[model samples]
Structure formats: C-alpha cells, structure tokens
Target: MDVDFTFRKPIDVSVILSTLLDAGMRSSTEGREVAYLVDEDGMFEWRTAAEYQLNEVMRELGDPRWNDRVVGMTLFFAEAETGGDFLFHPGRESMSCVVGINPKLFQGSSRFCDIGWYLANLVPLLEPLGLSEIEARDSP
Candidate 1:
C-alpha cells in the first residue's frame, strides 16, 4: 500500500530530522522497532540526530526532479526486515510509508501491515513533537 501523510504546518528540515531521530532512539530503547536511514547506494545505516545533514543527503540521494524545489528532499527510513519504508519529503509536507513493490506489481505484503501499524503509533508521537493536521491516505 502507498501511505501518505501531510503535516499541518510547514516544518524545517532540521526539525523533521531531529524528530525522527528522537523517535528512532526512543523506539530503540523500548526494543519495539527502530528506523534507519537508507542512502543512495542502498546502504542502511543508523544515524543520530547530530549526524544527519539534510542538504547534503538530499543532494546525494534525492530525486533530481525535485532538485530545483525544496520539495526534492527525500529520506528513506526503513524498519529492519519489515520490508517497510517511510519516505520523508519534508519539502513536500508529506511522508509515504510503502511496503514491498508498487501496487501495480504486487497486491501488497505483510510488511505493509507491519509498517501500517508502526506508522499508526508513530503519528501520535509526532503530534507531540509539533506535527498537526495529520491526514493519511492509502491506495486501494
């Protein structure tokens, strides 16, 4: 499934990165689940809030189509072995959680459900961090 969420107010890239990192850290401590930063070379590396440079990452991994606009910033955060990924594009005011391949190629996978559950709980956490007017969309 293709899950998309939009925040109420425009958020800074640095703030978004920090919030996600904080969430990752909390999840890690709780032993629930943690997200990793997937780079352009498909490397899944764990990064802390201080390690992320939004501009640098965007330039290295972001889609060229969005290069001209701030909206091109794309950060892929995936849960280990879940086949789930949260694609954060702060510039677009949206984040997408996807599992397996696109709907056109596959019906959907268990990973989708796993990520769905993760995102469901995450939304609440994000609200306290400054996200509001949250809206979710899933592909049929």
Candidate 2:
C-alpha cells in the first residue's frame, strides 16, 4: 500500500525540508531528478538534495509517529525518484504525493504519527504565513 498528503496551496519546499532536518526525520539525501533541464544533462541518476533543492532530503534513519500513527510509509527510493508526474498516478492527475517532514513534526516517530503535532507545530509554523491544512490519505 501507498500513502500521501495534499496541500491547499504551494508550500515552501525549503521550509518543509529544513523542518525535516530540524525535527530529525530521515529520508533520502539524494534523488533522481533534473533541477533544471538546461543546467545539466538530461539524466535521472541518483543526485543528492543539493543537486535538486527544487523539491526534496537529508540523511538519518528513524520512523516518526504521532498519536500512534506513522508519518511516512518508509520507502527506500528518493522523493524525486518517486516519479516525474508528481501527485499524478497513471491515467490520473492525483498521485500519492510524498511530503517528507521531520519526525519531530509528529513529535518523534517512535510510535505515533499524530495530527496533534501538526496542529501544535505545523500550524503556528505555517498558518501565520498561510501554509497549513494539509490532509493525509491512504491508498492501495
């Protein structure tokens, strides 16, 4: 099974990334994407976050949870490697979007992936700037 979340607006990818790092969540520090089609050769090799800050990672190993929920499904592939058509599934426009946040956002993934943490943290963290209210979903 696969899971993902969606936002009402375009979020600051940087903030999310920095937040993940700060919260100590772990994903892939590298992905397979082209930051700018013209800047580099059209190659989809494993590239570090620095290679494409355009979207997503850092480096660590931890499953953050909130209120007995898992923040992420824990995939070995990089976010960019997810697919070119982000949030878009085959023959569909909505894909399982993976927005990796730090485990701290969920108050540590030791067990639960709680929404409360998002309310307490993500809200104040983004609401002020109007970047909150992302909904999570589970898909097969």
Indicate which candidate wins on lDDT. Answer: 1
Estimate every model's Cα lDDT from 0 to 1: 0.45, 0.32
The C-alpha TM-scores of every prediction are 0.44, 0.30
Tens digit of per-residue lDDT, candidate 2, span 26-74: 2434443322111122232233334344343321111121112111122
User: How would you encode candidate 1's per-residue C-alpha lDDT over 11-117 as one tens digit per residue?
Assistant: 44445555654555222322333334534334435443323344454333344444223331223333433334556563646665555432222236532244456
* 10 residues in a row with least lDDT, candidate 1: 67-76
- Model 2 scores worst on lDDT over the 10 consecutive residues at 58-67
